[model samples]
Target: MPPLNYFVVESPDPVGKDAYERIAADVLQDLDLIKVIDRLHIYVDPKIPLFVAAGLLRHMPRAIRVSDFANVNPGEKEIVLDISEEAYLAPLLRILWARFGKENVDQPDRFTVVLPAGVIGQKEIEQLVVADPSETLYKDVIYALQYIAPEGFKVRRQYIREGKFYYVASEDTLPGDIVERVVAPLFEKMGVTL
Candidate 1:
């Protein structure tokens, strides 16, 4: 396997939940070559917020492509979708509903949906609204970072470019050296040497 190239350091500020989701999506899109190993962990201390992410560098999973997650099946009057393992559930459902009409689609669970017959092709679903194509993925990543941070902490961030992921926590000012020292022993104890 390639050497691990992504990191998730804690942020200095707190961010809302929605913002964090967007940031995670954006980062996955921007790095375009990284696979998120796990969901981001946001911890809110009384004064500051922290973030931790771990993953391998790779392309993000495609949202519109049927193969990306859902399997489309043509039924007599509706299209049945088996989306058991797909991650982008919300956006996919939104797009499907918008294209097929709210009344035409039925979502009984997180992993299954029924689309009316009139809208069974890929083109219709692919046209669903998404984040502006012109917008940089980094902006989304930052938004996600903010969302993932605690509501009280105030900070922003960018992609994890180098081996060391960067972060700015809060006005309180925690030094980078101190963070490294603190994390080092913990990683060492866990038998993780980077």
Candidate 2:
């Protein structure tokens, strides 16, 4: 599928659409989230200090497993992880330590961890989850929206699911019909039912 199409669907100030587009482009590119999104509809009403960002992601990112990053060797009483890539090394070590404890988990080198002496089953190590990119992407999207939205609009609400997200921000307490006012019209225009 193609990358997400981002647009300023509605804004209080039509002239400001260009600026918002620029900001969105920069922020999305900076976070490496441009391609993951399939469509983006943003609405900003500075006069009311309201901003909404709604988008559908292309697909859910896959979970990172222990096998994805390291080679697992199951021995008689322990499993040794030969961490090939260092990118997930820290988190991998942290998870191992958390699961097996500081004493049970050992790191003799920068890229090695041993689950000394058969405390857990072998399959557990193979199926360990190192990280979930979808979770991280959700947080990144939330943080990016904070930057994209006007600063100081602290009241925020977000709805994120498998591969879709909706966010809203405002300075004051938000009204109930805000979604109708902000996202519904954009969705309708995009031919999206919800």
Candidate 3:
């Protein structure tokens, strides 16, 4: 199992606690999020029909840009891009075409791209963001939480803010003070503030 600085699943029933531990572990692993989660605490109170998950995330990598995998250089008549990794070729091309019309951008080969002179500056091209891992990571975390929650526990609240993430769900309308009552205490157990 990948290391999570802290992990716990609490329930009034010991059997239910063990089952939730297994389910949460399997779901986090399946979504490839075990390493990204620094600490986690899940509290399931079936008697009250409530579930809460509080967690802190590790520092995530920054966005992917053209310069990360390609080289931009000046050409006699145009700007040339020498791509080193093919994985980003498709997305790189899409961004270029949208920013500078397709007429101004041309790809002559699998790993080469040409842009008309004065169309865009080399520095600007290098900094154009192609993908942001944090954006996708937030979405993935929400999906994983939803999967871990008990079935029919549909009413939900989720947050990804300031290096922290939280999820709360219930079959009935949640109490107005869930954050102050249940969520805050759970995060306190992990040495984090919600």
What value of lDDT does candidate 3 attain over all alpha carbons? 0.90
lDDT of 2 at 10: 66
Task: State the weakest 10-residue window (summed lDDT) of model 1.
Answer: 54-63
Q: Which is the winner by TM-score between candidate 1 and candidate 2?
A: 2
Give all TM-scores, in the order shown: 0.38, 0.84, 0.92
- Winner by lDDT between candidate 3 and candidate 1: 3
**Best first by TM-score, ranked:** 3, 2, 1
Would you list the rank order by lDDT, best first? 3, 2, 1
lDDT, candidate 2, at 55 = 82
Q: What is the per-residue lDDT of model 3 for residues 1-194, given as tens digits with 9 covering 90 to 100?
A: 55998998999989999999999999999999998899989999898999999999987768999899999997779998999999888888888888888988889998999998887788988998988889989999989999999989999989998789999999999989988988998888888676
Cand. 3 TM to true fold: 0.92
What residue runs in model 1 are displaced by over 4 Å at the alpha carbon? Answer: 1-64, 122-194
Tens digits of per-residue lDDT, candidate 1, 8-77, equal 3333444644455455555545554234332233333344334433222133323245554566677678
RMSD in angstroms between candidate 1 and the native structure over all alpha carbons: 11.5
Tens digit of lDDT per residue, candidate 2, span 1-194? 22566454567787787788788888988888887877888888888888888887878878888888888888777778899888888888788778778998888998988887577666777688888888888898888888888888899888777676789999999898877777677667666756
Evaluate all candidate structures by whole-model CA lDDT and list the values in order. Answer: 0.48, 0.81, 0.90
